[model samples]
Every structure is written in C-alpha cells, then in structure tokens.
Target: MSDPVSEAGTIPVNDSTPILAYGPLVLDVPGRPVPLAMKVSAPATGTGLPIILLSHGHGMTTFLSSLRGYGPLADFFAAHGFVVVQPTHLDSTALGLRESDHPEAPTFWKSRPAEISFIIDHLDDIEAAVPGLAGRLDTTRVAAVGHSLGGHTVALLRGMQTRDPADGSTVRVPDERIKAAVIIATPGEADEQTNQDMLNNYPVNKYNDFSTMGMDALVVAGDKDLNPMFSDRLSYRWDAYTRAPGPKTLLMVHGAEHIFGGISGYDASETTDEDPERVSTLRALIWAYLRSQLYPDDPAWNRALAAMGDFGTVEAK
Candidate 1:
C-alpha cells in the first residue's frame, strides 16, 4: 500500500507496509513456571522512533492470545514507524492455563499488568531480537494500547485500580514508564443491575474505579457495542472515558460492535459489522493521538480530529 500522509499529516499509520516481526521470544518470569513470550514488530527501518506496547484482549480462543492477534492495529502501528510489542498473557486460551494452573484464574488481571511491566523492564532485549532494530527506538516515548480486556491492563498501569477477583481487595499497580495509553472497548464502572452476577463470576469487574486515572489517554467506544454478558445498556462501555478525569479523549464510533470491523483478524466471522474502512479510521485516529501525545507541540492530533469531525463524536479535554 502507498504511504499517504493526508489525514494524520506526519503519522502515515493507515498505510500497510513491510514489517519485521519476531516472536515467541521467551523471557522467564521470576517465579512463574510459565515463561512470558511476546512478538516484536518494527518498520524494518528508522531510528529514534516511538514505542507502543500492545496488549490483546482475552479473545474467545487461542489465536488472539498468541502472537497473531490485532492485525489491524499492530500492523498499522509498525508501518507508521512505532516498534510494537505484544505479549500473550497466561489467561489466554493459547496456553490453556487456568486459575488451577497457577494462582490467578479466569483472567490474570494482576499478572497481566506485571507482564507489561516485565516487557518494559526488558525492552532492550526485545529490541535486539529484531534485526536492524538496534538503537532505533526512543524508549522514553512509549505508549500502551490495548483492546477489550487488555484495555483494563493498560488502565491499571495508568492508575486505574480494580478489585482483586482472588481476594476482593482493591489493588492499584502503576508503572511510571507508561506515559500514555489508548484503551478501546474496555469496561467501566460495574453496572449495578446487570453486573452483580458478573462481579461474582469475575470479582475484578467490581474494581473498575476511574477516580485516579490522571494520565494521558484516549478511550474509544462504539455506539452499539453492548456487553450482553455484563451490561443491559450500550452506554456501559463509555464508563472508561465518561467516568475518568480530564486529559483524556473519547471517540465513539457511530455504529460499531465489539470487534469493530474485524480488528481481531483479517476476516474473522465475529466481525458482524465488517468494514475495513472503520479499521482504517481507528488506525488513523490512534496514530494521531499517539503522535500528538508522544511529541510535544505536534499538530497531528488537531489534524486528525478535524478530519474525523464528521465520522464520530470525539470528546477531548
């Protein structure tokens, strides 16, 4: 695809190009028997580029948990000159591990953030794994981007605390390395009426308190992306943005679903609302946000919001 710098000005994040991908790079977690493995993607060129540590949502099955998920966002970010690192958490169906398998079960909410922190702690090793990628990254300009359940992980690192499903205790584990974040289709305050049982099933759901998210972030949601299992209303997903403090932006897609136009895969059947244009739209918006947030005095965010003025409602503070 041709690299077009139209809407986002400098960040040509929508154009797909040659990307160097290295994966399954095993890193031994301190005490866990299971190692933390991740995949790295680069632009195949460039130096002093920014970094994006991406986390995939706990998908229905293994593929999304593996190194192959989020083709839309991961590939786009790499093409635009950001080194992307994605880690498969222990909760993934790919590993088939459970609460019985280790300690954190159902969803490794606590462990998930630690995994991201681990990756950040060892960025040099990850960067060296990819050929022609040495000294090509600006480690200080890092952002965390996550979708679905993975979105919750980024929030935690950014100061959003959740109740521990294991002990019913409120836990907040923040990593100062994460300067900015972009969360998509992630949960918000627990719905009192609809999520009582869900809270019991996943106690951490009750811990989504947005009182202290004082970091830079962009929350993207879909108008129709309702959580049938946890919410009776469509607005439940908006809690991530609406409830959080300022210095955040909320982009609500006009008529998007959970998958948001096949972002999970190139052509997954889950995309009941398949529209590649929507995928491209999100890519552009996110890159613009990342670009502006990462670099001071950058106007890509202004240009992006102006370009997307007609597509959706972007509430920024």
Candidate 2:
C-alpha cells in the first residue's frame, strides 16, 4: 500500500529515506496494573527529529486499537522526518483485561491522557530501548495526533474539560509540552441534540467542556459523518474545532465518514467510506497541516489545500 501523498512535492519532506520501526517496548509505569506497551517509528537517518505521539482509537478490533495498529499513519510520518510513538491505552480491547469496578471502567478516559504524559516524561528510556534512536529526538518539538476516542484523549491534553463522575468535580487535563495537535472524529458535547442513549452508554460525553480547549490544533471532521447513535447534528463530530478557541484550523473532508476513509488501518473492514484516494488525500492534508504548524515558514499546507480543490474545505483562525 503506497501512499500517493508522500511523493516529492506533496509533503514537505526533503528526505526520501526508509523508516526504522521498533516496537512493543514495554515501559514499567509505577502503579499501572499493566506496563505501557508502545512502538517507535523514525526515519532511518535524521537528527533533531520532531516527535508525534500517535494515539489509537477505542475500537472493537483486537489490534486496530492496540500498539500494533495505525501502521498507515505511523509509517507515513516516520518516513517524513517525525518520530511516531503509539501507546496502547487501557481502554484498548486488545488488552483483554476488564476493571468494571473502576469509575472510568470501559473507556479509562482519565488514564489515557496520563499515559501520554507518562510517555513524554520517559522519552529518554524509550530512546535507549531502541537500537540506534538514542540522542536523535528533540523533546522541544512535539505534536499529538489522535483518532476517535484517542481524539478525546488528545482533546483533554489540549485543555478540554471533563467532569469526574465520582464527585461531579470539573477536570481539566492539559499538557503544555504539546505544541500542536490534530483531533479526528471525536465525540461532541452532550447537549440538547445529544441522544439520551448515547449519554446512557457513555456518560463521560456529558462532561466534555470544549470551552477551555485553548490550544493550537487542527480538527479533522467528515461532512457525511452523521452519527445518529450519538447525536442528530452533523457538526457534532467537529465540535472540538468549532467550540474551542482559535489559533485553530478545521479541515472538513467531503463525503467522508467516521473513519475518514479507513485511517484506522489499511483496508480496514470497519471503514464504511473505504476509498483509497480519499485516504491518500486525507494523509496529504494532515501531513501538510502538521508541517505548516510545526514549521511556520512551510508552505506545504497551502500547496495541499490547492491540490484538494474540491475534495475538502479548510478554515483557520
């Protein structure tokens, strides 16, 4: 599966080098029932490489939501000068462990963001774990990208507020270390338009306070991602972009669904809008957005927008 978007002029990458992927490097997180299992993908040759903490969605698939999933994204970013780290959150079905007695049981929403921060705190150990990746990572330059429930985790890291169901206290979990972020297909607020069934199934949606999400981010939404299971409003998916404060960009992909043309994995059976071209276009646009955000002088974003004349719409403030 070749990514058409990674061609010479599409992405802002000067190096067409091969990427080195090393994985399942378990980290001994104190107090965490299970050790943090993750994968690292980076360019075969590069110095001062930026980092992208990639978060997988809480999907039903055994592997798609685990450390082994998201090869499509991890490979592309690694091939283009960024170090991508994927951590399997507690909510991942692949873990096959359940703590129904826990407050945030199924989703483990609180632990998800903490896991990201924990990874950041232990980048040194990670670099040492990999064969030749030591002394190459630049801790100053970091970005986060997430899909589905993973997007919710990134949203919380970007300062989105959530309520602790136990005591009904407001919870704001943000990471100042994350310079930029890309949130894809996350759930919206539990307002009037929200379906009662959704709230009953996932009560945490009731606490998503996007008003405090004041960070530089690009929110990717699909025009056709209408989730009647959650809400009747089509805009519900992009609420993080629309409701959050600016220094933000919104990329609304046309004719896309929840998975945004199978971003979860290559030829993923879960994607209803399974179009290869659409996935390629999305990868290009997302890469361009991250490039431009990380490098102010980069024009990759403008070039990508021009290329996507009718495929999608982009708005920034």
Candidate 3:
C-alpha cells in the first residue's frame, strides 16, 4: 500500500519538505488503497495545530495534474501550523476511469466519501508514524478546502446529498469529522435534474443539517470565472440561500479568475497568479475562520476576519 511515487519511509521534519506520503490505508473500493500527499512542516511554538484536507478540482487528468496547477497553498498552511492532507481524487477528475484502477469505475462519486474516510481513519496511525506531526494534529478542528468541482465534493463531505438515480437512494458522506469548509468557485447552478435530486435528498431548508456538521464556512469566487453567471451572481445567491448560523462568509475577488488563490499548477495564463494582496486577504480570512471556530477566545482571529475585506477591496454582494 506504499505510494508508488515516494520513497517508503517516514519523512523527517524540515522547513523545505515538499511532499510526504501516507498509505496502506485501504479505501472502500476494492484493491484501491488511498494515497495522501502532503507538505509537513514544524508547527509554531505554543500554538495548537489543526488539520486541513485540501481537495483538488476536476480536470482531464489526475488530481496530481490539478495539484501541479495549484501553488504552495498546502505548504503555506503547513508552515502556518496546520497538517494539510491533499487526497488524489483521480477518479473524479475529467480523465475519470482512465486515471483510476478502481473496480467500480463508473460510481466513483458514490465512493469519494470513502476516500476521505480512509484518510480520517488513518490520522492516528499517521501521527504515530510521522514524528513531526505527533500531538500537532487537532483532529477536531479539521476543515475541507476545495476548488471548482472539488468544492462540490467538500459540500458533499459535509453531508450534502447527491442522489443516485439508478438505485433511487442517496449517497451520504461517511466522514462527519470535518469541522468547517472553504469552497472556492463552486458550481452555483447544477442541471435541473441534479438540482431537483439534491433538493429531494438534502433540501436547502435543511441547510442547517450540513452547517451543523461544520464549525464555519467561507465560499469564495472570482468575478471573471469561466462561468460568469455562477461564479458571480449565482454564487452570491446560493450563499444567501444557505447562510447557516455558524459564521458563514462569502467573498468575490475582483478581477481574479476561477483558479485564483489556488496552488500554482492550474493558472495557464498566469492571469490567476496569487496577488500578494489577495493571498494575504485569503490567508487572513481562512486563518480567522479556523481560529474563530477552533480557538474562539483569540482576539487575533476576529481581528483577522474583520480585516479580511480590506486587503482586496471589492463590491461583492
């Protein structure tokens, strides 16, 4: 169950450690073991660390392909005292079954929760095996951060339902341990049928069902995304529709594209390059949200969240 890409052993803690691998964690899908790639760094002294599960977007290639597109967002989080687990949801990408060898290729989405569950199930083992991460992981403060289609996956991980028409049943997420989520550029409007199915399975009226599962959430998008309608207006609409009680925030980054604020690999135009100001804003918002939820008494958290909109001033509804 070793990762085919990395050397099989515990990676020592280092400031520049690029990739750490964890495996032997069997997925629910037969014969497919879950592989987690992460950036591990020493936590800041006296600060309790939290875990962030970063999910990649869908594309015509593997999750690694998308990873190559995102910059060091994961490393940034790790350096800031968080253990980031970036799972390779290869089957869910555009390349689909071609990238995964899972026996149940067609029903990949139904099993994504299992992939997440596999990782959650192994946190104790991972902390034990990797010295640097020992006692540093605050599992209760976990967050799911995803981009594009990956954002949808994050929602599902928080118990949002996606109906299986074939079986007339719903696919519920197995891992309810995620305390908060950040969904970037999520598709605002699904097809009519899918929308109806989602309503039937997990109605918007019961959005509390999903929000209660998490501590807080931030949904961010860009004004000039690929789908202008969804990325802009619709995103705001959806956010308004489900403004759950646990401190939800919606942000629209001006002049940014769909892939902005992501890791370096996806920005073909370099147009979506992380604006230092925008990145600072994003870091501030995310850190604030996590802090407010995980360590409510910290004034710095509220300060950061308050100052989030100042960095990249915009007229987002």
Candidate 4:
C-alpha cells in the first residue's frame, strides 16, 4: 500500500485499482427467521488480503441500511486491497420486518454481532460464492466497521456489555476473531441528558457498558452529531472512545454530522453533510487505521495524521 501524501492529507483513494464485487450470497442459518444475505467486494488481484466486515446502520432509507448500501465504502476499501463483506441485518427496512415480529426486532442488537461472527465463520463459503476470491483472503486478519446502530454491533464484538432486561443477566458478546474495529457515530452511556422517551423505547441502550471494550479500536465521532432523540449532549457519540479502556483512538471530525458526509452510500438522501471531500478524507483515515491495526509496521496511520490538516483531530490512548 502506498503512503498518503503529507501535502494533501489524503491516501490513494482514486479508483485506480479494479475490483470484483458479488452480492446477495445467501446463507441460511438454522434458527434464523430469514436467510442471511451479504455482498463481497475485493480487489481484482491481491493475495493474503485482509478482511473487513462492514455492518450497516439503521437509516431512514429503505435500502441504505441493508447490504445494498455503503457502496462508497465497500468500493473504496475493495479497490484499496481489502476484502469487504457486508451483511444485511434483520433490522433493515428492506426486509419489511417489524419490532413486533421478534423480541429484538428494532435493532436486533444481539443478532447483529452474531451476524458478523457468522460471516467470519463462513468465510470459506463466502470465498466459494464469489469468483476469484478463493485463496485470496487472510482470514486471521479480520476487522469490523459499523455505523450508527451498526457501530453498536462492532462495540459488542469488541467486548462492550449491556444487560438483558428480560432475564437480568449481563449480555457480553465478544468475538475474539475480530482483531480490530472502527465504531462510528454510535450512542453513548445514557444519562440525565438522555431522552427518556428514547430510552423507554429501546431500554437496552440504558445498559451500554463500554468499560470492557479493551480491544484495539478507532472511534470516529462528529462534533456536530447531536441527536435530541438520544441525548442533548454533543459528546453523546464519543462514549465508545472516552468510556472504553486504552489502546483506542478517537477521530473527532469537526462540524461533521451523523452520516459523516454520505458514508452509507453515494448520493444518499439521508446524508445531511454531503461533502464528497469529507467522505474521501474519512475513508482514507479509516483505511489508514485498519491498515495500521493489521500491519503494525505500516506508516499509513502516521502519514494520515501528519496530513490530517483541517480534516479532523486524532488522539490515541
């Protein structure tokens, strides 16, 4: 991988490398109500490639929150030498499923992380499903990235805890297979600033304990990503970084919003911050983080930091 230029504060994000993307590779779980559908995208040519499991957010759009969305990211990462796998979770609006349909209908929080692990469990099948992907992936080097509710999923995989109110048991679902993670715009600890109505609806949000998220992670937050529905505090989205233990980094994008300038998809109607430059910078930053995490000696992260002029601020602990 080429190092990012200090002058531009950008990595090689251009679509110079060709890619092969295959989709709707269905996997039928024994007890799941519906089959798990996913998409696989990888550089047209690469061996010993790392894997990135991208989880979609619960967005207002019908399909942006499903496997069909996040083209901007999936394509970018694939073009940059990573096997990007995206799973359409149960909470997606495209599935036409409702909260009354299942006990965890709204977000399917537990099932979300399970879905990621399930994907990792079936890497062989995935490779078999997509042509030219066989013998290309380095399964041991896997990372997870998620946005919004999807970010919550990555946190769980990285060892965040939340209590199950139904049985009064602590629910800590972590997958050791995921070596690292990038949590974007996820909700934080509920406090007096939190909206009572939102908590009442999604009671699980009240128990989000980040103290045990000890894995190497990059938490990306936007300074302007304020949601009254969740909390009035501007730092509501920074909980995963601030509350979690060490070996974590925070990328606070100035004046950004929940979508981080259309990360979910290209020309997405749900994006309030529709700056392409912002989106490009974000993908580069994330690419650098994942690269540095998977390959410690790589200078992609450090180069990105030096070139982060006006893009955002990065702090690690």
* TM-scores of the candidates in the order shown: 0.92, 0.94, 0.68, 0.95
Q: In model 1, which regions exceed 4 Å deviation? A: 1-17, 99-101
lDDT of 1 at 216: 67
Task: Tell me the TM-score of model 4.
Answer: 0.95
lDDT of 1 by residue, 106-182 (tens): 78888889999988998888777777888998989889998888889988888897776667788888888887799
Query: What Cα-based lDDT does every candidate model obtain?
Result: 0.81, 0.86, 0.53, 0.88
Error of 3 at 168 (Å): 3.0
Minimal lDDT window, size 10, model 3: 5-14
lDDT of 3 by residue, 1-317 (tens): 85342110121122433434343222244545444443333344423568877776654444433334344566556555567676566454434464455543433554555666667777787677665556766777777787765666676776555555445555667355877677776544443323444334333212212433243467776655654333224443234225434455666666666656443353334435544445545654665556556667756445654544434332222
Worst 10 residues of 2 by lDDT: 5-14
Better of 3 and 4 by lDDT: 4
Q: What is the RMSD of candidate 3?
A: 8.9
For candidate 4, the 10 contiguous residues with the lowest summed lDDT are 5-14
lDDT of 4: 0.88
As for candidate 4, its clashing pairs are none
| Deviation (Å) of 16 in candidate 2 | 3.2
- Model 3, residue 274: C-alpha shift (Å): 5.9
Model 2 CA deviation exceeding 4 Å by range: 1-15
When 2 and 4 are scored with lDDT, the better candidate is 4
